[model samples]
Target: MTGSTNIMIRKLIRSLEKQKKPLWKTVAEKLQTPSRKRWYINLYKIEKYTKPGDIVIVPGKVLGIGNLTHEVTVVALDFSKSAKEKILKAGGKVMSLYDFDKLDLKGKNVRLMKQ
Candidate 1:
């Protein structure tokens, strides 16, 4: 990951720590490679850590490198072409991170993380 991305990831981790009941959890074991090179988020982790109606954020970009079975909404900063299609096909919704901030998160279980 780039320095800026690392900083953002740290910020997210800190934010998650403050919540009494975090909307989601990070369950994957650490990989040997750095984060940026592994642009794709793990669908299994998302499914395991989040529930329906949770919004997932990817600070960089999302790649269509995995299968998604959960029906949660994904609001990322950006997404690959195939990622968008797969999300929609799986009956999930997709939105830009910018649009997600405009909505009210009150009483909602939303997960904002860098994936």
Candidate 2:
């Protein structure tokens, strides 16, 4: 937490840690690290590993390097403009980690993916 330079990301790390939930803590720990260590998932991985209607969490940015073939909800720290467009075009939802936090979607129904 002390090494993180981004205040907004730092705040997210703290807030998630304060939740006192195991999954939140794990996500907080991942978020607390430097940007270089975060995941940078692409559309292809999401498409290859997930099925329709799945909620996916990427602890870093979501790049628009590939195509999405199904509808799925994706939550991440950042997303490229094209990634957002592609997700919407594929009938999928692109959400920020903060927005995903608001939904309080339990870990059970969510699928956490990394780059």
Candidate 3:
């Protein structure tokens, strides 16, 4: 990982330890690998695999090559401008892993979306 991505992974790990969210820890582990191995989920794939109101964590960035018809919570290291806009337009929530980890959302229904 590069400096920025390394920092993000550290933050995710720290947050996982503090928040006691096992899922984030797993995602952080996945993110620590080579960049080519990291996830980069597209909106269309997420739309197909997830349902409305689901919480999703992408181990890398989110691309905007597709559209999302359902509102869902998306937590990731980065997002394309169009992806963020589309998620918001669909009444979804976009949160950074660092921010999402600070929330009192332990045990909620969350899934890791990787590509």
Best by lDDT: 2
Candidate 2's residue-wise lDDT over 1-115, tens digit each?
Answer: 3568878888888788887667678778788777788888889898899988888888889999999989999988899998999999999988888764576575455788865
User: Which residues of candidate 1, in runs, are more than 4 Å off?
Assistant: 1-40
- Against the true structure, whose TM-score is highest? 2
| Segments of candidate 3 deviating more than 4 angstroms | 1-5, 17-19, 104-108
- lDDT minimum window of 10 residues, candidate 3: 101-110
RMSD of each: 6.5, 1.8, 2.7
Residue-level lDDT for 71 in candidate 3? 94
Question: What local lDDT score does residue 16 receive in model 1, on the 0 to 100 scale?
Answer: 45
| Candidate 1 lDDT over residue span 1-115, tens digit each | 4333455555544554454543323311121125555345655556667777777765446677777776878876468898888878878888864453354556657765544
> Candidate 2 regions off by >4 Å?
104-108
The sequence of per-residue lDDT tens digits that candidate 3 reaches over residues 10-108 is 676666656455776677577667777778889998889888888888878999988899899998888999999999998999998767735455454
- TM-score of candidate 3 against the unseen true structure: 0.81
- On TM-score, the stronger of 1 and 3 is 3
